[model samples]
Target: MSETITVSGVVATPPELRRSSAGVPITSFRLAAGQRRYDRATNTWVDNGTNWYRVSAFRALAQNGIASLRKGDRVLVSGKLKVRDWDNGVKSGTDVDIEADAMGHDLRWGTSRFARPEAPASPRSNVEDAWAPEDDAAGGEVTDAAPEAAGPSADPGRDAWAVPGDPILADGEPASSPEEPTQADVPF
Candidate 1:
């Protein structure tokens, strides 16, 4: 079972926004959370090692992250905790990763104003509408700029993620409008 965890940390790097091969939005960054201990002899807080984690967010959260977060900012992140084992020729170790469900600036250090992202014109459109691409100044219209594919092997050939009105099968007919989900759609 995956465990949910929350950690407040300083942003160690700039947020990088990229798209998966299936056209899903994603963002990732390094977070550094430190610890301090009071020393009786010195009567001062002693430095303790800092724990580092890589945090990743998907879809709307990913978009919001690009707009809201920056390097060195104190932020709160809560999500599923994943511990991964890794090995190189010389050594092996575990790395911590958080698949963030929610993230925002920590208000304790400073104040922030909340602004709701603009609503999409229609529900039928995808969330990509929330982050529109910039238009070229030369007046040439460019549509369907493919998003960055997910991994090293991701390529145009593998991009078959379905969008609204896309054909569900290879029969070449457009799909009908999506309907509300029912109990069967729930994996649980």
Candidate 2:
């Protein structure tokens, strides 16, 4: 039986990334969660013990993990835990593995940056504004020579994240800046 678990620990080994014959990606790494205890006798903290886990991430998580994780970096992983007994001619033991569903750096120890991928193109042919007038009556040819005439939206291709009050918000990208994606934008 497998149960969901969340664990935070240091990466014990550098993540190994591999792809299956079918081209699916997978990244695996070892995690070490150490225990600390306060020693009243010595007036200091002491190392208690450590627990290790085998973590495996698939798909985009695997790609990200390979790019981001390094040995000794602190991270939090949430996944389904599976304990399996394995026997070798020399020895036999139980291995604890976590098939990671979500994982990220532990910000308590350090900081991390996030970069979101651009949305994939949809089937519907539409980049122009839906409500924009079909016909341009006001001499509507945007030229590089006269960017000011087009108002604050000088470049209409890349300003979805423009600030609400910024001059660039005149009439180009969406009014509201979305951090990630919305269900409506996805064509499925």
Candidate 3:
């Protein structure tokens, strides 16, 4: 039986999206999770060795992973975990891969905005088709164009939460342009 596991780590490589011969969309990435600790002998913070994992996502998760995550971003991934042994012509080693069910940016690292995709009209339509990229040419390799940024607004002053500059009201509207919301304006 596959074990479900959750892990948080920094993205070590850009997510690469590809399609299987059967046309299933898949995305994979390398993650580096370092263990940090205070060394009593050193009297300072130190990083224990880092563990690496290969993360794999299928279907819509594959598409979203490419669009939402990048190298150096901190993310939390939860899914079925598998370990496999591999041997090249020269050497061999065991590798760990997680078939992700859910993945997202770790909020402890920073904030994130969410936008849901529109539902398909017909259930019969293939979801993978929507996630798959068009081929540049028949039998040619797929282009690796970077997906547009969807993390934060271009304007630094805008956040939906109750920040000093942009304060969202009870009704979910921004404060008036005349003035920023004062301490009294927020309900608490």
Candidate 4:
């Protein structure tokens, strides 16, 4: 049977990163989800239950998780349910895990912003300098290129340029000048 599950919980620990035999990056962590309840007689607050699930994230997701996540941070995880059974010298039982497809911080807790890091002024090696070239194709070293004239130029008078057999205007009609406008030209 196919099932879909989503859990929002606090991270119980920092992600543990490791590589598979194939060298794929994987990170494993535990998530703890809990809710509050009230006793009918005493009317005292109590934890209903805490569900702890092992979560695994792969590749880029794993890297992001390791960098951005911390213990006690709340996150939302969505993915398929996985159950594993293991038998060793000590003990064995089926453990529930989540093969997380998407995991991210619940931003309602806080907000953050990122700024781009400035490029290093001087590269250490020739190889690094060669890989990231400083010059344009014309071989001139580029400090900056003029932005406005960077694209193909168009004639000021023409409404639209015509390709060989394809004419811009239909039935040989004269092209509409820029100054002319109709009801459609009015902005809402």
Candidate 5:
């Protein structure tokens, strides 16, 4: 059976990073999701109960998540759900755990801007002629000129190519009429 699940919620606490017995890095945190609805009889907002999940990340993902996330940060987590059952002599309890495949901040709450760690050292080559200068009127240095306007001759012989009863194509094809096409005649 597939046990994979995805959960999107707010980080309930800062991620705690640790190493496994085999010395692999891991980070764990809790996520809380809540829903609200209006009660018809009460005419007030009602809590639809909150879902909490334990989330874990591994290696580089764990390191990044621990460094980037903080308490109350909204995030989307995708992974498999693992049920952990433990008995401490007297009673056994079960909890939901998520082995996170991917985790990232939910941008709807706020905006995050990232800057390049370092600027490239190499000089940029003028691969396009867009910046090449044109000769100035005084001939001292090159400069850009205003773009020229289209002339009457620009459309020379264009209209002559049209044929009578050829149904003048609007722009490229025949103009669409006001009538809506029926389902059978409609192109998918």
Candidate 6:
């Protein structure tokens, strides 16, 4: 029997996606969850030991999980948990695994942006494909040529990221060689 549980942890391993013998998609990875305690004596947080869980997802979940999950990413997983005893010829141990029902990045730990994936040959893809160069009969490598600049930049040779009104010439060369700013030069 399996128990439903929610686990928040860092993905300890890169997710691996594969096809089953029956052609079902499967994605699996290892998760590491650790406990942290506030140590008043030291005025700091201390990490306890970590628990490891093997996570697996199937079907569409497997495909998306493989695409989104990477090692060291903090994730929240809700699923059925299984504990089984295993005894190899040389050793005996217990395995903890989670068959994920739903999983995603843990927002509390960091920020994430969500974008729905679309099928190929999209309008944006068509525009991108136009920039790609075709391979020749001798060279079988396909690569994208440098994209054309939209138009002539107002100052082509100038660093586009230069400070608003510091020192630049019409030809886009620096008016003077840059020097480290002393504390006095700071407005603040």
TM-scores of the candidates in the order shown: 0.64, 0.64, 0.65, 0.56, 0.56, 0.61
Find the number of clashing residue pairs for candidate 2: 0
Residue 183 CA displacement from its true place in model 1, Å: 58
- Report the lDDT tens digits of candidate 6 across residue range 3-114: 9999999999999999999999999999999999999999999998899999999977898899999999999999999999999889999999999999999989987655
Global CA lDDT computed for model 6: 0.78
lDDT of 5 by residue, 22-110 (tens): 98899999999877899999999999999888999997679778878899998989998888788999999888889999988887777
Error in Å for residue 32 of model 6: 0.2
- Full-model lDDT, candidate 4: 0.70
Q: Candidate 5 regions off by >4 Å?
A: 114-188
The residue-by-residue lDDT of candidate 2 on 1-188, one tens digit each, is: 69999999999998999999999899999999999999999999999999999999997789888988999999999999999999998999989999999999998998776654333354554443222322333434322233344457656444233333444443564457658878997897
Question: Each model's C-alpha lDDT?
Answer: 0.78, 0.78, 0.76, 0.70, 0.70, 0.78
Q: Write model 3 residue lDDT over 91-167, tens digit each, in one string.
A: 99989988999999999989887654655455655654444324222333333221222223333434332223335
Which tens-of-lDDT digit does each residue in 1-188 have in candidate 1? 37999999999999999999999999999999998899999999997989999999998899989999999999999999999899997999989999999999998988665555776666656555644333334343433323243334334343433343334422322356567799999798
Off by over 4 Å in 2: 118-162, 165-188
- Give the residue spans of candidate 3 off by over 4 A: 121-169, 172-188
Better of 1 and 4 by lDDT: 1
- Candidate 6 least-lDDT 10 residues: 142-151
TM-score of 3: 0.65
Q: After the best TM-score superposition of candidate 6, give how far the Cα of residue 84 lies from its true spot, in angstroms.
A: 0.7
TM-score of candidate 1 on Cα atoms, chains taken together: 0.64
- Model 1, position 174: C-alpha lDDT score: 35
Model 1 residue runs over 4 Å out of place are 122-188
